[model samples]
Target: MDPEALNPVIDKAVESGIPVVMFDADAPNSKAYAFLGTNNYYAGVTAADKMAELLNEAGGEVGVVTHPNQLNHKERTEGFRETIEKEYPKMTVVDVKDGRGDQMISKEVSEELMREYPNIKGIFASEANGGVGVGKAVIDQQKKGGDIHIISFDTDKGTLDMINDGIISATMAQGTWKMGYWSLQFLFHLQHDIAGELEGETNLPRYVDTGITVVTKDNVNEYYPGE
Candidate 1:
């Protein structure tokens, strides 16, 4: 999220009497009206907690697999690193690898990480492809069945299967349904329902957290689409 690059475009929209609201990812410095999607930082914090639990809270070395170019991934990595550093002082994020949001790239990078950080006890995948790739690396390195715990993001069916098969410890499921549903609601309100300023504040909310859910083997069936 380059504020310098995005703010001018958004500011132009606002100046033209057009409103812009961000979803999923954001450049808060931009002149966007609101952001309605997952609270990515909080989601990262939760992922760290889950990773700690999977590691039995022993606090060992872990790594992160992500797309370095994406802002949301950066935020997640930041939150995960901060939580581990502050709350679990014994654990260290040994390294962070860029997957470039590609399955093959994520797998290759994760494999390299495993070789470099041989003692890594946990891995956090900050996106769908990163999770899939890291899961494959764990299996290929003969470290399956929770040997090197993995906490991934997204509720993809393949990811859910990995959770059941014990390749991934769990996954963070975003409230995409809520995001899609409420996007229309928020837009509708912005189009016609928003009243004028009240006590120097607008009627619209600045941010709406659609929320997240941790999907594990126990609840994989509930999240996965059935045949």
Candidate 2:
């Protein structure tokens, strides 16, 4: 997600009086009417806490694989990195790799990260493919036994498979359905003023936090919506 490219478009849409609502990922610099999605930074904080638990509170070096260009991914990684540094005295984010949200690329980066940080206790993959790729890299290098804890994002099938197979420890599940459902509602509200006029405009929150669910092996099946 190139904010440089997308921001201009969003600004144009707003100028043309088209109410633009951003979902999941946002172009923050643009005049987007509102954003409806998870509070990604807090979600990252959640992942870090989970990782701390997985490492038995004896934190160590951690690596990150993420797409830094996107707003949401950046927020997730920042949240995770900051929490590790501020809350966990023993842990540090030693390195970061640009996974670009590609499975193969992420896998390659994960393998490289492990080689560089052999004693890396935790890895936070801030995207779904990156998580699956990190899980595969861990399994391939024989590092899955809680020695290298992993916290990944999203509830995709690949991430779920990683959790079920004990390759990935846990992942953040975004309220995707709510993001979609509310984005439309926000758009409609922008045009129709459904919430009723306040002052000179309709009343609507600029940001709507759909929230996240941490999915682990114990609750993976129950959270998976389908059998």
Candidate 3:
């Protein structure tokens, strides 16, 4: 269903007495019981920070590629653009391409981007597949990876490999496993009649900060997934 089309279904679920929590992205208008995922907007800002740290000096066009038309990607791009414009005014965002979440399409799109914007100084990917796709493009083109900073999302195996080999400069980490675990845990509690809201002013993390981390070549080894 289209994002606009999801609100009704979400409302129906909520009406039927189901506690809903959206992962990866939130449905602001829907009656979602809670949001358990990364602070995507901040994640984009984090990406910009990583890019600035990697480049050390700003004043180049930043290109973003992701699954086009996705609400999450759209928010990320907006956040990244807003931060870059406010903080690194010299760094112009030249273009954004749609990867369609397909590796082959991502490669093709990345190749096209390379040709269109040869001076692209930085690249930001908002999803795992897109990041790996862009990584493959950089490797295939034989560009000096370090010369052009690349920031990606997630810690998938392919992304980790790229970080290790120095193809991707950094990646934004997300707690995929924790999201599933907590979502179910919350649902279980709701079903068990446990109070959903906080008891008092003692404070409650209204949203679970599943957390995020920046993975780079310098610290990539530290983030190797558990065997």
**Highest TM-score: which candidate?**
2
Candidate 3, residue 105: Cα displacement in angstroms equals: 1.4
Using TM-score, rank the candidates from best to worst: 2, 1, 3
TM-score of predicted structure 3:
0.87
Q: Say which candidate scores most in lDDT.
A: 2
* TM-score-superior candidate, 1 or 3: 1
Off by over 4 Å in 1: 1-6, 143-146, 193-195, 199-201
TM-score on alpha carbons, each prediction? 0.91, 0.91, 0.87
1-68 in candidate 3: lDDT tens per residue?
A: 14566888998998898767777677778776777888778888888877877767558877888865
> What are the per-residue Cα lDDT tens digits for candidate 1 across 25-72?
777887777888888888899999999888878888999998766778
In candidate 1, which residue pairs get closer than 3 Å at backbone N, Cα or C atoms, i.e. clash?
none
**lDDT of the candidates, in the order given:** 0.85, 0.86, 0.79
Ranking by lDDT: 2, 1, 3
What's model 2's overall lDDT? Answer: 0.86
- Quote the lDDT for 77 in model 1: 90
